[model samples]
Target chain A: MIHFDQVSKRYQSGHEALRNVSFRLAAGEMAFLTGHSGAGKTTLLRLVALVERASRGQVLIGGQNLNRLAHRKIPYFRRNIGLVFQDHRLLPERTVFDNVALPLVIAGARHQEIARRVRAALDKVGLLGKERLHPLTLSGGEQQRVGIARAVVNKPPILLADEPTGNLDPELSREIMGLFGSFSNFGVTVLIATHDIELIQRMNTRTLVLSKGCLVDD
Target chain B: MRAKATTPHFERGPRFQLRAWLLRHLQTLFSALGELTRSPLGTAMTAGVIGIALALPAGLYVFLDNVQAVGQNWDGKVEISLFLKDQIDDEAASRFALSLHKRSELRHVQLITRAEALEEYRQLSGFAEALNAFEQENPLPALVLVEPTLRYAQPEAIKGLVAELGRLPAVELAQFDLEWLQRLHAIIHTLKRGVVVLAALLALGVLLIVGNTIRLGIENRRAEIEIIQLVGATDAFIRRPFLYTGFCFGLLGALMAWLLVEGGLWLVRGPLAELASLYQANFLLASLGLRASLVLCLMGALLGLAGSWLAVRRHLRGIEVG
Candidate 1:
């Protein structure tokens, strides 16, 4: 579950990114965050992930307040939330399997357990046969799939994606959305932030639209 | 069921966590080694600097040990000679020697009467013909040679014993070369202290070397560190590989230092033996033995760990999750 109550983020240079945004997504729910380039969709996702703490009010995930979390506990806190970026963020030097296994490794899983989960996650993303191949050698869509596989490999309860299909073809975008849908069906909460209005319309899920620094519509 | 089966399994229990912790450390240990091997030349150069620094003090320590052993050997050969007054005759000197022999501090006492002294002087001295002029008087004084027990054979104890013996009514003088022996002891003591100071400075240098190397390693892997941090890798996990890198540098550097010390000692052994033979003394150069070498390696590893810890603490805070 994810909840934001009057959350606002202001940069050090006095630029306000988000202002008094409020939303709540129940467990196993899937939603889309839609806005233009400077509308704070990324900032919202960052607040939920605790990458950048909300400058005002509260951002909560699974009943834990992001504002009051101690600095040392941030890593453990992030473990329960999976994040994907527009650029895929796959380590180019590592094999596809190693990229997916990162989250499980961070969780200190056993070697055999990691291998098994990584293969299964790769299978979910339709990348099972490309496990040994490096990300640079893979196509753009395939690399994005690897990133999605990595984000879910550890089976985090909540998933956050920032324009994960921004660079993919429309067909690949639909497939990635389908993966998120199936994950939500299995009782995992999923939130996607994107600027592609057409894709958001096609998603047809609970959508929150941001304009300027305000949550204009939900 | 298929979705449920893939749900993350949290391995609980302290024993299981500890085992996993150890397994992760083992993995990092080898991975760090692999990282170093990937940049062989750079690693060797850094380790070589550490080795030379370590070897300097280690060599000096071994040298000091050898010198102290030789000094102890000479300490065993101390002898005090007591010259009797003119009033002390042969029978009186022999009685004095007997009394001195009974003292706990004296190991042995031998009395040489005036007649025996004159005879020894006549046979050894080339002035035997000239000494015949004083044959009637036989002016040589009676002497008692005193050898101190091992405990009292040192310069300080010998000085005290000499002073006590000089107070004897029949003894004209109690003499030993205490000044030269004291000088030798002073030199060795000063050199030992100097070696300790040098060792400490060089150890600090080793720490700096390891720290700098680890700093560079952290800098090169900045992206990887940031990404891992974002993916829920703890600071400990991010720090593990760098610490291991420093450890490898220290361990390998210590091994290098050991080889340098052994080689240096080996090169000097033959020449040192020849020099000892020229002085009519048998001496052997002592190398850093197995125990000492192992200790050196351990010190290296510890220094490496400390250096990397310092570097990581200072630099790791600069990198945060994006």
Candidate 2:
């Protein structure tokens, strides 16, 4: 579950990334965030990830107010939320398995547990056979799958993606969107930030549109 | 295929937590080692630089240790030379030397008759031709050399003994160069202090060297660090590998320092032994023994850890998932 209480983020350079934006998503709900390039979608995801704090209002996840979270507690808080990027953000030098196992490793999971979970996650992404292969060797769509596998490796309750299908072809984008749909179906709250209106229409999910740092439509 | 993907959470006991913590550290340790091995030349160069820095101080310490050992052995060199009165004949002086030898404070006493004294001066002073001009009547006084026992070998004790001997019958002057002995000790003390200062400076240098290397490593892995941070890796987890890298650098550097010092001492030992033999001293060069090498290695490892910690603290703050 994610909730924003009229959050506003004003950068030091006088740029407002988000302005008085408020939204709430129940557990297991999936939603798409649509906005122009400079709109506040990425900033919204960042606030959820606690990469940046809201300047004016409270951002809550699972009823926990993130604005009050201590600096040292941020890592533990983030463990419950998975984030995916457009570029995959996989360590190019590492194997697909290693890339996926990172989150579990960060969680201090046992070796056996990590191996099992990582394999399961990889299997879900159809990357079971490419575990030993490095991310760079994989195709663009496959690389994005590796990133998705990494995001859900720990079975985080909430998954956030920022333009995850940006670099993929239309078919691959559809496939990636389907992967997100499956995660949501399994009770993982998903918020995908993208400007791909056609893909949003095709996915037929709840959409929140932003323009000039304000929620224009939802 | 709808898989039941509900998250399962379990509470672990402290023992399990500790084991998992240790396992993670072990993984990071080996991974850090592998990273160093990946760039063998660069690692070697960095480690070599640290080795040279550490060796300067380590070598000086071993050198000081040997010098102190030589100083201890030469406690007998603090001898008191007693010159007999001109009226005292050779037999009486020899008898006096024999009597002096009975004292517990004296280790040895040898009588140098006037003729023997003249002959020693003629051979050593380069005044053999000048000494022949006074061949009929030798001008040198009969002498007695008295070496104090080890327990009474301190400058103060020797000075006390010299004063006591000065008052003895048939002794014109109890001559001992106490100033020279004191000067030797002063020189050794100053050199020891100098070595300590140099060691401190070089230790600081080692810290900086390791710190800078770790900083560069963090910079190069900036992207990976950001990714890990975004994925909820704690500062401690991200820092573990870099700390290990520094530790390996320090440990390897210490090994290299030991080799450099031992190899240097080995090469000079032969010449040093020859020199000692020429001086009639049974002295051998002392190498950096096992205990000292172990300490050197420990210091290197600690410095590496500290340097990497400092670098990580400073730079990790700047790389906040940007």
Candidate 3:
């Protein structure tokens, strides 16, 4: 559901983060974007998320060209996509339930709908009973699950995760990958940017690799 | 034996849904409030600082208002006194009074003949024995008390009128009671300038105080904001809570200042009344009116909103999520 055509992003200081990157992911497909540090993986995902514009080419999500979207319309465009970060990114002062409910809140769902959806999402991540607990009180795996629940709470069609399992153990990482695989089964397109070769091999999804500022292979 | 339950369908119009969309973002408002509540002490301190800064100028404004009120009450009574020549007789003085009465500049003119003035003064002053001890006729001239029209009560106008009156053959000396009015006008002018300078300096102080507080807030919440942006939250969404926080601070500060000013006026009202009583005059201290209060509150809110907006616009750009 994402297409990047000859995408390039260059910083103001003349450093190129992404160089003529081209990729396409089909609907409901899951992919692992593998790269080292400063390898343009994050830059590519950022382009898809429309947080940063492509410097040279078109980045399309669904059928809409992000480069052509007005700045005021960016928020509406983002509602169809969900993003999870490696750090969980939970507001530490809030409960797990509230953290998971953030996307719905942003989407302006009804209170009852928020409570119902948040509970269900937390249940899917095996975090139902822990909703009242704060993020600081949860383990890294639990916190990551909370972040994942938050990402999918609005039932976004496309889910992007940046190093989702970066801090988890091997077992926890596998479980997280399995969770993403389940999301794919539910027809949600998922692109996970990671450097975990073992996890990628185990999941055996489509793999896109990047080196320096260019996409080397897919 | 139970039948499968069907999901109920409720369809809302697109416009209604759009409104709902806006309503859903109330979380941003709540989150903003929550952030402020997280550090009640800091919020209170910041608001208190703003309140005191605003109160200084507001207090001065109130004081100047009272001064203006007192000046206005005295302005109505301003008049001129004309002393006739010692040789001028009653008929001549009476004729001069009739001429003065014909002039549109004077509101009222009363001719006080020398004998009548002496007898009236003697009866009122309770000094009949001193007047009787005088062997010769008293030297008090025919006094003409002339009340000027409001427009003619000004220093220049009164001076001009006095000169005109002095040229009259029946007059010996003509004096316009304009010195005190001149001094009062000068004082009022100086007060207005002082208010402007003091208000400007205090407003600057308020801006700095609010700016620094907002800066601190940005620093404290930098991480959380980065996370929000990374998760596809727009800059407007991220900036909204800070703006509300600043508004709350300003609003609360203004309210506190209003209270302080009213309290100060209340505390001094009794003494002011007692002092007025000693002077055998009725005086009322003025309080801040509704319009002034609203202006103060609006000022506080705008200051806070602007300060926060500046802080957020400057600091948020430097924080990159990707």
Candidate 4:
């Protein structure tokens, strides 16, 4: 579960990225956030992931206020959430399986468990056969799929995607959305931030729209 | 029920967690080694610099040790001459010399009767034939040549021993080559201090070299580090591989330095022995003792670890999730 109770964020350069944004998504609920290029969609997701702290108010996940989390606990707290980026952010030096296994490795998983979980996550992303291949050798869509596999590999309760399909074709984007839908059905609280209105309509799920630095519609 | 049971979050037994922790450390350590292998030339260059830095001080120290050994050898030969009292006869002087040999401090005592003293003086002095003018009176007094044991031959110890011998009733006066011994001890002391100072400076150099290399390593892996941190890896977890990298660098550098020093000693051993033989002295080049070599290696590794720790602690703080 994720909640933003009147949260706001401002950069060091006096740029207001978010202003009094408020929203909540219950456990197992899937939603989309739509906004223009500089409308703070990324900033809002960053707050949920605790990658950026709110300048004001609280951002809570599963009832734990992230603002109160100590710096030392930040990494461990991140174990409970998953994030996927538009550029895939997969390590090109490692194999697809290793990229997915990063989270489990960070969690200190046993070798057998890491292998099993990585294979299972790769299967979920329809990348089970490409586990041994390098990310650079894979197509952009496959690379993005590997990133998704990695995000969910730790079995995080919540998953956040930031323009995950930005570089993909329409077909690939739909497929990636379908993968997110499947994850939502499996009880993961999925939230995707993208301004692709047509894709959001095709998603046909609950959508929140942002304008400038405020949540205009939800 | 099946989904809950099959979730990746299986029950973590205490033993299982312990094993995971061990596995993680080993993996990181080995991965650091693998990373070195990935860029062999770079690693070698960094380690080579550390090796040269380490070897310089170590070589100088070994040289100083050998020089000190030579000084000690020369010190052992220093003689304290006890000119017997005029009333003392050759028999009395011989008795005193024999008694002096019984003391633990004196290694050797040679009694030179008044006749032998005159003969030795005649053999050395250019006015040898003129030395016999005292044949009737034999003005050269009966003498005892004293050689102290190696330990007592040191400048401070020899001073006390000479003073004690000088106070003997049968002895007229004790004469020791004090000025030369004093100067040798002073030079040895200065050389020892110089070795220590040089070692410390070179150690600091090693630290700087290791730190700069580790900084470069961190910079190269900056992207990966950010990603790892974002994916829930703790600072310590992120630092483990780098620490191991530093450790490996230090260990390798120390090994290189050790080899360099030993090889240098080996190459110079024959020539040094030959020079000693030219002086009719049995001297050999002193390689570092086993303990000293081990300490040097350990020091190298520790410096490497310290340098990397400094580099990582400073730079990791500069990196934030935002």
Candidate 1 chain A lDDT trough over 10 residues, lowest sum? A195-204
In candidate 2, how many Å is residue B214 off? 0.9
Provide the overall lDDT of each model, using Cα atoms, as 2-decimal numbers. 0.87, 0.89, 0.84, 0.87
Candidate number achieving the greatest DockQ relative to the actual structure:
4
lDDT of 4 by residue, B271-313 (tens): 9889877766888777899998999889999999998998889
Candidates in order, interface RMSD in Å: 4.1, 4.0, 9.1, 4.2
Per-candidate clashes, comma-separated: 0, 0, 1, 0
Q: Calculate DockQ per candidate and list them.
A: 0.37, 0.40, 0.26, 0.42
List chain A TM-scores, every candidate, in order: 0.98, 0.99, 0.98, 0.98
User: Ranking under TM-score, best-scoring first?
Assistant: 2, 1, 4, 3
The best candidate in terms of TM-score = 2
Question: In candidate 2, which residue ranges exceed 4 Å CA deviation?
Answer: B1-11, B83-91, B101-145, B149-152
Instruction: Record all residue pairs in model 4 with backbone atoms less than 3 Å apart, i.e. clashing.
Output: none
- lDDT by residue (B85-181, candidate 3, tens digit) is 9888999889989989999998999889999888887877778888888748785788999998988887678788899988888888998767877
For candidate 3, list the clashing residue pairs, or say none.
A108-B24
TM-score of each: 0.87, 0.90, 0.84, 0.87
Give a tens-digit lDDT track for model 3, residues A97-192.
Answer: 988877666555677888999999999999999989999998999999999998887777889999999999999999999999999888888999
